[model samples]
Target chain A: MIENKTNKPQRDGFWEKLSKLNRRYIYMSVGICVIVPLLIRMRLPIFITPPTKSLYNVVDKIPPEDPENMLIISFDYDPSVMPELQPMGVALLKHCFAKKIRVACMSLTVMGIGLAEMATEKAKEEFPDVKYGEDYLIFAWVPGWSIVILKMGENIKETFMADYAGKSLDEFPIVDKIHNYEQVPALVCLTGSSTYLSWITYANTRYNETICTGITGVIAPEIYPWLQSGQISGMLGGIKGAAEYEILLKKNKLSKVEGTASVAMDPQSITHLLIMLFIVLANISYFVIRRKK
Target chain B: MSTNIWVWIAALLTLSVYSFLYKDNPIYRFAEYLFIGTSVGYSIGFLYWNAFIPRIVRPVQAGDYIVLIPTFIGLLFFARFTRKWTWLVRYPIAISLGIGAGISIPLTIQAGIFRQLQATMVGDFTISNIIMVVGVICTLFYFFFSLEQKGVVGGVAKTGIWYIMIAFGAIFGYTVMARIALFVSRVQFLLHDWLGIIK
Candidate 1:
């Protein structure tokens, strides 16, 4: 046959084969690598960075006031980034509710309303007594991004007349008492976009509200200088950031707080290591081919 | 392993999208189309329910005079569909751009430039602080393209390149982590929520 006559493995065939590897095989390997580690529990050492610790300290040390008006945690990202940012919402809610700190949760982005609702609902399951519109409230999404934040500094109820479910703010005795950013002690903005800038511009600078941010990993480094300068009070960079927060709570001998962020870290760490190994292998093959040529 | 129909749908759609890692085919195209269609449809429904219903519909019903101005301006967006009245859309666009520009200039100068410059000056006197100060100066000089590369400027510009490359590498590394985090999230959903293989 023509294959038998012409086809023979060359002396340098190994590197050439590696260099010409099909993309599908690599994809499959990564998929398998992620799924296998995910099927079991692996406790990865999550180093708690100072920025993340600062956020925890801020959230933790907030005075548990009567009627529980302490923080406004803004859920500003949709489901597309729920994987990275939602964990922070869940952890923050658990931390607040457990400490008996009242929070008024809202979202600036329309798509983030569902995520905000989901995170709040999930956290409340742990502590059944944390009633909606009492200990915690979901304001949901308003139309204006920067305008909403600006108007919120003036009057929150005027900006959002009601909560997510068409209920009058008048009915909720807890939320009715809360108005404007001046009343708010701390604000945590979790976002997948540039909505954080609006919060900083209007909410922080104008009203002088204490603001922390939990942003996606891609935007983390860009905002690092902000954290160092104390422009923002605290920060959670990504899922790993969320995991670090979860760890901080668990270490304090608090209630069970292990959730998606901690569970997902194992696969994340393994996949990252696998990627590095592949990069090395790829470069080796590239160099081998170039030197031979 | 999962009884929920929603989980099954999510799993299948995720697989279809991941199929793009191989050569593009009908499955990937279907997934892509589905995602776009779903996003647009969801946005319309969400904005209406969460925004327009409460902010406009309820307010105008109660005879709030202030609500009418924004409502009229919003209607200008639909003018793009009409040939003769397309130019009318410019009024709303101009108002928005003017407002946005007016707001952005001061805020950007305050937060983006002023606060950053303020941060650089007032850091603790450490080795990292020294590096940061040097890095910022060199990086700023590197962007000065008006002046040709001469001896001292060239040396400073070269140092600036190094800082710029390091920052870019940090960004690239974070970008990789972001992408991997996204993909891994989908896989986690498949395993934990969809398949119920792990909890």
Candidate 2:
């Protein structure tokens, strides 16, 4: 006892002590920090940079009703990713509907059906006069994602026998003209995984279909090669990309629901910054302890 | 307060969930448990509505005995909870795997393997495309089984690593930008949406 047994638990220095706090404590503080700012309606002025500008231009250039024009929306994500993707899906659907483009929706993942339905429902709510059969059709989820693309290019009708609502695809006026993949002007993949690469291989390879992607931030890096090599025309990755797409749709005066993604952006930014700071501090502490050793 | 009060309460509970990051305190623990319970409850409800009621019970009630095939398979999933009956789960797994593989591989061949090859072969011949092609070739060749690395082929393979590194760097840079975008979004939320200080 007199010797101060165990050397007082080897008291860590300032930086070391800071690093030793339970990770959950830091996580909780971060949660509060992010939530408080979001609730207060704090937002930064977003500059319309080149990437966002390009995204806007692409959507703008497409005439909403060009008959030869076909837009494919691939729903490859589930409800877990809805908080980030739903807004983007809604915005994209709104833009296509406003333009009067024929919309063909397909799902690779089973959960994607819900997301696809939500998009169509939102579109119908805003564009009330829009007829389902005449304007759009929802393809039921298929098991094989890449094969579905190939089959779509080869024989679109054989691929999707009925719409999600059980309506025959042949009865859908909008989809009546889309017998194959070559008719599609663009393919948009919304996924939380690297299935974008498969789109490249299938659509771009067999059908020569132009592809774009809206994927989660976690899976963004893996798809850059396609983006760089011109296999993909554009990409909207993660929450930030969603916000950017919202700005584009909002600016066009298409839909007011654009605020959903933009509102969430602030909290996302703050949390990221905090995480980066923590990482830097952790690294500095690691180096300091190592040098002392 | 009326029936709509539940919405506000739910919102408050959702926020409380976020509060757990500060510490593993009671509020966070409570929220965590609530989320688990609610999620399980919702899933069970969904299963009953979407799976059991529509697929099994309704079919049985309607005197469609054919539904029993799927009904039996569905019940087999519960075998996962029993150590003795665990092998029964594999029957479903095998069927699912077979479907998954049959669905994915041929299509993957058409997409991931064959389609990628076709793209590379017929790609644009511009300077950027050419560089990309070279990188792709070198990268592909780097994994060549017959080509040993001791000679010029080895040198090219080593150079392939450089190309790969560059590709990786570009991806990394894009990732950084994406992360930065997330950060910017969250910051804007705090400043503009939450505090009304910025817009």
TM-scores of all candidate predictions against the true structure: 0.94, 0.69
Off by over 4 Å in 1: A1-12
Candidate 1 structure lDDT: 0.83
- Return the clash pairs for model 1, or none: none
Candidate 1 lDDT, tens digit per residue, B1-199?
Answer: 8899988998999999887887789999999999999999999998888778877888889989799898899899899999999998999999999988887678767877788889899868899999999998999999999998789999999999999899898877777677778888898888778877887
Give lDDT tens digits, candidate 1, residues A1-293: 01223465345478778877888887888887778888876777889998899999988887774553568889888888888999899999989888888887888877777888889888988887888877888775777678888888888887877888878778887766677876787899998788788887777777778889999988888877777667788999888888889888788855585778888788788878888888999999889777765
- Docking level of model 2: incorrect
lDDT (C-alpha, whole model) for all candidates? 0.83, 0.70
Which runs of model 2 end up more than 4 angstroms from their true locations?
A1-11, A47-63, A66-68, A123-126, B1-199
lDDT, residue B5, candidate 1: 92
Top candidate (TM-score): 1
C-alpha lDDT (0 to 100) for residue B190 of candidate 2: 40
